[model samples]
Target chain A: MSSTTLDPSRRGAHAGTGGAPAGGMSGTSTGPGPSFFRVLNSEFIKFRTLLSTLILLGCTVLVVVGFGALSAWGTGQFAEAAATDPQAAAAFAAQGGDLAVGVPTSGIAFAQLILGSLGVLLMSSEFTTGMARSTFAAVPKRIPAYAAKLLVVMVTAFVLTAASVYLAGLMALPILDNYNLNLDLASPQSVKMLLVNSLYVAAVAAIGMALGSLIRNSAGGIMSLVGLFFVAPIAFQLIPGDFFVEARKYLPGNTVEPMTAVQHVPDTLEAWQAAMVLGAWVVIPVVLAAVLLKKRDV
Target chain B: MIEARGLTKVYGDKTAVAGVNFTVEAGRVTGFLGPNGAGKSTTMRMIMGLDRPTSGTVTVNGSPFARHAAPLRDVGALLDAKAVHTSRSAYNHLLAMAATHSIPKKRVHDVIEMTGLADVAKKKVGGFSLGMGQRLGIAAALLGDPQTVILDEPVNGLDPEGVVWVRNLVKYLASEGRTVFLSSHLMSEMAVTADHLIVIGRGRIIADAPIQDIITGKGQIRTRVRTDQPDRLMHLLAGDGVSVELQENELLEVTGLDPRRIARAALDSHVMIYELTPLQASLEEAYMELTKDEVEYHSLITTGAAAPVQSGGN
Candidate 1:
């Protein structure tokens, strides 16, 4: 049975000798290992094939759109109440009377959480399922695959966040117009918010992937991501020390607000400083993960 | 060809694989046989460059696996059947692995049909039975049509037909002048499948020789005797360089004694002997004798006292 099933001539006939130059030349001498682009393509295929990853991405879109609509309605209510109360009016005026600009990014927090977990799961599942063996066996250099996965993950998170934020703005447009509120989606502040928030989410996803590679477990990576993005900020605020208060401003999550503000808010980081902080948050862990991935056993 | 020079792996306080050296040549099936927890998988992983060796080097062909220009093209390995994400379909899994080396879509489809995974190619691998998973792994290994094939227990969890299919497939692969290195814990399977054998136990090489030599060599001589006066013959055989074990009412298994010596003693002692047969060691017996002292986790089975079985079970 196996003799009939494994006919080499028949199998070879379909293979078409396309890689003969690489295969035959490399038969005695090495031809081409996994180049960066090939590994990226491989990682992208792996990234898109899993149903769980698609489900998580879908949930991110739903949550972002839902929160955008809800925030628009709440802002409309505040604007309506401003006419009857001086304090409410003052608050509305202080908000620049354009609460609608912030509505599109109202669900950025949830998007970061969901996409960050997705990043963690992507890398951790490789180790958990023993897929690392096959992956590294193909590209034994190891760093190219790790870098390729990181690029795939960060790019997906950025594109998804930016696209979802834009969709949310479109969805919230009519809801804000019902209360006589004007929102210019093309306004510089709105565009700044979208780009900065998207970049911030991409950074978070990179950090999550780094944690995943380092920890090699899904739950642990996700928990560390949550602790860095969610728990640390609240815990730092609750602490009484001045150092904690100052350190909170440098957190990756806090950087997004300062970065997107029309003007620098007092007591917050400068835009350039915030960008550098976020860049550090991303680069440090990613470089560390790549080094360890190359050095350690798969 | 594959070569290892003092390859070793140490984890925490324990050494999973100690310093070991051996070479696997091309154009033949080399079976790596051992009991469970014998570092067969670790050695295979090192050869594929998935695990870093502690203080030694292992090279496939001429250079280390990592140094090859195209690893997947030069060598293919199925280190484990579950070395795949369960949520992905079998087809997608092969496609993704193939993409790493720019393997064509046609080749991907070819491997799927070749491994008989065409029926469930679209289904999630998590839902696959063990046999189906093994087939998927084999398909992935052959995706590049590599020159060297390394499989760690390819017949594991396979049905009888699947087992025979793998046996013939590997032999056919070796016949094509490719290097085929396979691993299994089953001695009977290795007896029929492997041309050369490298037996490992407790992370050490117990025997590295041709399959026939391992079967016939290192086996002691033993003769079985059946006598009416077994007690008298047993006493007569009790001497230096002799051991006797009673099998039944009139049967004795005598070691370190030639059949002629036993018969002469039986006749001189007026002990009527009916059956005196010499026993040639089978592969199973030879393997047991070779690895009896090298087994790492010896099961403690006492007649009256009992102990819990350890975690490492095949």
Candidate 2:
């Protein structure tokens, strides 16, 4: 265990800087540095190595699939009651005659909460545990690491949510079949619901990561995330002004409903408007967090 | 090589590191010595680009650290032992840090073994002792075989053997023409391990010179004398530019005079002196004198009533 094994062969060429080499130590590294792809790889490694992060991902799958099964049974019971009553049948028909399409996504609300908090923890833990010093030291520009982590968080959120939703749909197939209801998982409406919901979850995760970077505390970041996605929606609903109602429609949580709706809901914004609003929700905080991260000392 | 110009860091109303300039040259082990809160860590962080300097600039290899193409390769630093996520395995933490520079997995394994972490590489970092954490930090710093190494308090929690290993390791690194800058409060360790020393006190550079020069520069010559007539020797040896203090009944500490002069005076005065010893200043004493006024926090040594009382009534 001698330091001789630690030495790498030095090259005389200096790679990055143009300044005159210091005397007697003219050698500089010629090996690979922190490119964008390398930083992305590093961030992905960090993302996958945490047991707590894996536990959160596992919890999301269980909650989503488990709720999908429960929703299937409940929707079956509702259809049975509609068969016995004309008024109930009319109400069911008003639901676009497709109660089963929404069954697979019934647990999306909880999925957002779990995965969003995961996003927040990913960034905030870097500060809480003092890993930010190592992280920023490796990529001193700072923005590349932030961008890389954001990409990892959002992509993982989308892929995991999409897979969980699909698995939940698979888990619900027999239950829906028992009620003689048809749910074509490959249908246009179903596909749109899956893709849109996954994208929406990814957007929520980006917002959570941004909040994490800005707050730099796991508890505070997660609380702010919950306040934005959960409490604000409810609080806005309970208030009685048109401004509150209009603002509620623009809340990130509410934007998903409008974008994923089969048709325009009465009180919701247009699908494009919801998409833009969601983009703003992610971009504003993310840009601000990047700016602050660059400016502040680790 | 690392250089700083007008480097300053101010936190609220307190300044951690005042504006100072110095260069850590290559091919030598430069020791940064400072008391607590004297800003050794702050200066290192600024050099590592972890902390933004309030005023000026610090550069490694002729440019700022953030400007380096491969910073890990150009300048590896162990700023703190806790600069790692506790939940991750030691191997995985190094792997992730290495992945940033596209360093190979073999290099990671090599550092792990080199730092004596082969046995606990799979364990979570949270479970590591302070010494183990330090080893991991050193392992990470060597992950890229960096040219300039900056370590703050590298020998802090190490055992005696580990301390010796660090001493040899820094000297070895410097011998390879690599710049090694380490900070420690142990002046004795600095006296032996470093070739050049930088002493900072009260957020300012108080002494920056060769280690030998710092040890011998400010200390005055002194002699200890023991005699039968201590008062007679004290009065007889008293002269211009000489100060004598009676230490005990027959022992005296005479400063600013050589031991021969004290002996000649004692012989001439028939003082019956049995002990005449010349005392050279140790690095510890020199450091105490250098930082005596610059120490930010002083521990009061109460000599009168703070002593435990003897129970005589029993």
Candidate 3:
């Protein structure tokens, strides 16, 4: 069974279904068949082929573009009043008065919500609909499937968010120019905002994926994501204690403020501390979900 | 070939699949026949590495299923018809699964054609009938051209024509020396399709043998003797363990006696026998005989002794 059997063609051959040729790796070959590269390609294909996923991607773009245009108009109205009122002068100075850089991704919150839900649906649906059986059947290591899906989710989240932000910037240019305010998509500050917001959304999507894998319920996963980003921060504030204030800095949702701020805000976590907090948010749940997935019955 | 050694799955307090070993050899259709909750699906899932077994180990060819580098090429399983995102088109679903193995586009279309899903390939699976959904699932299973094929209740929603198509397909696959492990409670279908069977009840295998042995090995053979004098035939054949039941005033069902003995007795008694047909034990009876006592959880509402009737008559 060692020499003549090692032809690779006949090694793992069971009953031949006998129409198409054997796929890339036949049964005869041994040792870690579906490499990470192959798994990544598989995950990419799974990511793009669904209509629901595409619809969510499309909605992210539309929301970003629409909100940028609206925010441009809002900033223009505020700029006109800054010259007339002393109180408005103070507010305009606080925003740097050239607010067009911020208009492009004013809808990052909604973008996070939609793309995060996309991440949740991608994984949770696999289990809810029984595709996990087929998925795990193909990549039984379980971790490969989990990691591949996470890569797919995070990459899509980054790309879609960045593209939406860019399109929003382009759309906001004319709206901002009508008020004689300068908007530059090429400026260092503008690019930093795009990169930071896109990464923030990517992190949020990863969190959503972890919740989905752990919860395995669509509504439940999305709800948990919402609780983390939207509800937790406000609830922490209303509770009114120094512990809550300190704990709020560690919340995954609070990382974006420190990242996007030009100068670190007073009484807030520094940029490096926030990055570590975000890293922990992604690493812990993802590892836990992967372990549980391998342990549970499909 | 699929081999299991002490493959077991225990969920919290309840034991679903007890420690049991079985081998699914290549070159034949091995039917995993079991009652509703008898752990057939559980075993298949474990084989696919979808479930972590509590103790035992199962291997496809030589290594554990998940350990395979290209598992799709090793095994293709249709665990359920609805194992798909119903929002996606049947074609796209196959395309995504195919992409995972780097299987080409042509094979995706080929399986769609082979499974007779050409018309509905572009349609969303959510709107599909159960039969169509089963066809899609079958297409997905065949996407990798895997060596070993595992199907759970492959014929559940198929029409008679579709069922026949699947039967022929499996037989052809086996003819090519491939391993086929399928589970179905439809004894009649198994009777025609499977070469060997492993009958499981309550997570225990009651009998594992060739189909013929299952029918003939466990019970007495009955011969139907249609005579003009039913009463005469019954009385004539009655002796010792022999018992005859009269039906339709002319037909006598004789058990514990072979056809030759019945004919000899009729000749001696001068009773004219019209139709002397021998009835072999059906798989239904054979299965009943196999599981009559082993049912871990029997239903409270007692239905006919469907198992014993056919087993005893045979």
Candidate 4:
């Protein structure tokens, strides 16, 4: 072995910087190490390249838009019935006669499930397919890659959900017009629904990804996500106890209503309390996942 | 260069790798030869910082792998052929890995071409044959043009031509003063490809030396003898350092004694031997000699069953 060739000073100077001397093809690299930005860029590439992830995103759009049109027609029929029924009319009036505004986000329940599963899949697949080895090898710090992937999953979930919700609203417009019902797309309430619901779904996706990293299996992660967001709430409600009822109100899925509601409904958490609850839901799992990822073997 | 000091890994009660220390220096291809269940892969994973050591430390250059400012540029590894998402195309897999280090598209394409994956680069890795997967792995390992390259079972599922290609590639990398450490269970492959050999078995280091020394050092001297009076010669050659076995009616295989001593014994006994051939021990025999006692899985055979044939001898 050549002593000069093993010189750490010379090698360290060029390592991770990405700035190599001329003819870098000769293995004379001056490349930059895996910075947070670089890892983020890599994660984005991974996110956009998979056909399955793209398909999930497309499904979210279709389901949201399809459910929007259906809900618009359903709301119009109910509004028509309320014209003659006094009790129905009183209930309709209590909603400020703006029930059509809720049509666009009718598919949100399904959106949360699909996008949340997508979140779980992206992280869990790394372990299942052994890709984590390559990923961690490049960024041996491990957490940078985890953070970068989380950013990609959450951002994509937010943008895709928001865009799908907007498209659903647009699709609901003509349907509602045919039924002689009004839906103001630019209304403050409409914008609040769009932004808050989008953010909520993004939070669910983050939680799903955290479960994925922690569980490191697709079915297990998705199942745990469903239990937290779906089954646990229903199960808690059915158990018939004061504690069960109180706990059901704090479920992640239940938090969305309070966050998007203009006024806090009775028996539900206030918007600020709901927001903190949702934040805790996301923060706890994500932090746990990050710590485990850093410590475990790839 | 890579260095390990008392590196160990224990999975529950099973010690996958005991505390073993060794250095893989630059400018040569060092082969890590071991059987299945040995610590080869576990040790390599520790060096890459993928698996935390239960105890001790390993370093690349002068620090832990995770501490390297530019880990990809400093070290690249093909720890497994399947260290990829099968649904992703070869091009995209390499692209994602390159993105971490801010590597250019040109470099990604360069590695693809270098690994002869240009034709299948766009196809999903799920459909790739094992050889193709190995090629893609090599492509990823070389994506950074790293100073140190580590490959585990690199030619595991390759055709003869692919095997030759990998052998030449590792040698070329070493020739350029890069530290090339590769592991394989095939002693013949390591004999020709590696300048130095680190023989491991049952989670322990059995031997570490130059390749040539291993082939010649532990392997005992054996000579093939075809004589008219095989039984008489067997009795004449019976001694502390010599054991004679009747291979056939007229053929006797002798071990532990050189041919000169055998010839002297035969001359004194006046037992004419038609053939006296010295058997040159190949790397395979030397490896078996070193690892025979350390193998983890021993196949049980009945007493009348045929003895295991030792390969790679001339």
lDDT of 4 by residue, A44-103 (tens): 999989999999999999999999989998888788777889888888788736578889
In model 2, which runs have C-alpha deviations exceeding 4 angstroms?
A1-21, A24-27, B218-314
If both were scored by lDDT, which would come out higher, candidate 1 or candidate 4? 4
Better of 3 and 4 by TM-score: 4
Chain B TM-score against the true chain B, each candidate? 0.75, 0.75, 0.74, 0.76
The CAPRI quality class of candidate 3 comes to acceptable
Which residue window of length 10 is worst by lDDT in model 1 chain A? A17-26
Misplaced by over 4 Å in model 3 are: A1-33, A96-98, B218-314
lDDT of 3 at A87: 97
Model 2, B1-314: lDDT tens digits are: 89989999999999999998999987789999986678999999999998999998998878889988888888888999968999999999999999999998888999998999999999999999999999999999988888899999998789989999989988877776678999987676787899999988767887788887766643356778888898888889888888899998888998877787788887787779898887764344555554455434222212322111111100
Where model 4 places Cα greater than 4 Å from the true spot, the runs are A1-29, A96-98, B218-309
RMSD per model, one decimal: 7.4, 7.2, 7.6, 7.1
> Lowest summed lDDT over 10 consecutive residues: which window, candidate 3 chain B?
B297-306
What's model 1's overall lDDT?
0.84
Q: A-chain TM-score in candidate 2?
A: 0.92
- Sorted by DockQ, highest first, which candidate order results? 2, 4, 1, 3
Q: Each candidate's fnat, in order?
A: 0.49, 0.57, 0.48, 0.59
Candidate order, lDDT descending: 4, 2, 1, 3
Better of 3 and 4 by DockQ: 4
How far residue B234's Cα lies from its native spot in candidate 1, in Å, is 26
